[model samples]
Target chain A: MGVKRFIAVLPQCQALGMRVESADHEHVLFSLPFAECHIGNSRKQLIHGGVIATLLDTACGSVAVCALPRFEMCPTLDLRIDHLRPAVAGKALYCRASIVQVTPRIVFTEGVVYQEKGRPVSRAVANFMRLGAGKTPVEMDEALFSPNNEGEE
Target chain B: MTYSDSMAQLVSETQRSGHWETLLEQIPYAGFIGLTAQTLGDEILFCMEPLESNTGNPLLPALHGGVIAGFMETAATLNLMVSLNVDQVPKVIDFTIDYLRSGKMKPTYATCILSRQGQRIANVQVNAWQKDRETPIATARVNFLMHDK
Candidate 1:
């Protein structure tokens, strides 16, 4: 399955309005547009730290899965994030994640979230356990790669 | 009243009335995620009911890892706000989370314990559990920079 389809299968990605800007075996970049619902501090109009964390986690997970030869269920083992600065309000947020290392059982990834090119909002490092084939839900496979489901959403 | 004073008053009133909904109304993201909090004596318990939008994997139908992290962080921040009685929102500096188990599609609960509270920074450890309090699905350590007003 393609990376975009894989991301589309996840419900949280849909809920957050995450879109695939670019993806490949080497790295994946995702974007989330700013919305009023994402505001953590209404008075300051700042996006929530958790929203940034969500973006990092999603990016890291997607990149890890894409690194595999085939799509598999990759469950996060641990994740760490550092917020360098507040994300710019009323702008789209972007996260670029890449695989640091890959083993038979685990995939390590690192990611950074930013609105502008030079200014980073947060950085993340995470690892996911590579649950081999057959671990993923059969229904999910059908929903992801199925010819009938294509162009539906 | 200044912003700090108003925040303090809001917190005290919420505590006295045991109405956490009033406090949550101010946080848009918390409301968006369907996060709820209830005062448990001096402590607070945060909860997120299973919502379809929060699910990651279908079939086993687990909650998204990011959602779990978001819930825990949100809980910690609110817990800090109530504990410190501060006016400004605490800005997260860093967060580390360990996933012990998959967050099943069910009601998840979390509580925060202050690890340390210095003048400028505060460290909070959050534990999230479903089914039982002892077996946590995820545990997180969050450090925040306090901007006291």
Candidate 2:
């Protein structure tokens, strides 16, 4: 199936408060809102770092499987993140991730989580290994973004 | 001793326990420097400073899912110290995050509430919010493998 079709059938990113901002040939844009529950300070409010990682993880995963020519599967092997700045509270954070390179065996991408008006909050490089079609559903379910599945919760 | 001293002492306790040190390096530099821990009753209060560069939008900034997962991981690891009733490094077997709302781009807080701490395993729940606990940005249930000394 085409990447667009696959994403359409997949479950909504309800838990992460994920919203699809835009998608193109090589890049994707997403957004998440800031609420009272995420506040950590009164003076210079900000969002938590963990939340940023989750967004990057999901975004990178989406980038990996989108628009492939064959029926190949992919899974995250490891992800590394570096925090750069503080995302001020009450302001939304934007993520701009691009697929830097993709090979037959691995997918590499660089993502940046930054404020709308300021410098980047964090940057990440993620690597995902391609899984063969013979893998079981349980194995595929853990890493691959299955449309009808909510993952191994 | 003063409050800051007490906090310093508490951090030392956490640091000496090797619990904080183990996971501190595991998180991205942004998360490690942003997260803070404190003693709260039988649990630990973990604090986070949201980075503007990490949110979804500039107009109404919010936290991302990956960031929350990292924070949850840290919170769960720290809580293992209390849940296992020991100060040692706990291995996280598996973790799940339930994003409730768009985490505000501000200082968020979470507390590790140990549900069960057995000889070999520990379970904890972490809740995070910006202002009111009612509107949670994310919620998580973590399982850890505890090998205490």
The models' CA-based lDDT, in order, is 0.87, 0.61
Give the winner by lDDT. 1
What would the per-residue lDDT of candidate 1 be over residues A1-153, giving only the tens digit for each residue?
466877776898888888899988879999999888788877678888878878888899989988887668889999999999887569999999999999999999999999999899999999999989778777666666677866764
List ranges where model 2 is wrong by over 4 Å.
A1-12, A37-44, A70-72, A133-153, B1-73, B76-149
Model 1, B1-149: lDDT tens digits are 87667777887777677788777877888887789999888889999989898888766778989989999999998899887777777889999999999999999999999999999999999999998999999999999998844
Complex DockQ per candidate: 0.80, 0.13
Q: At residue A81, give the lDDT of candidate 2.
A: 64
RMSD per prediction, one decimal?
A: 2.0, 13.8
Instruction: Give candidate 2's error at residue A67 in angstroms.
Output: 4.6
Q: Highest DockQ among the candidates is held by which one?
A: 1
Query: Chain A TM-scores, all candidates?
Result: 0.90, 0.72
Fnat, model by model in order, equals 0.83, 0.24
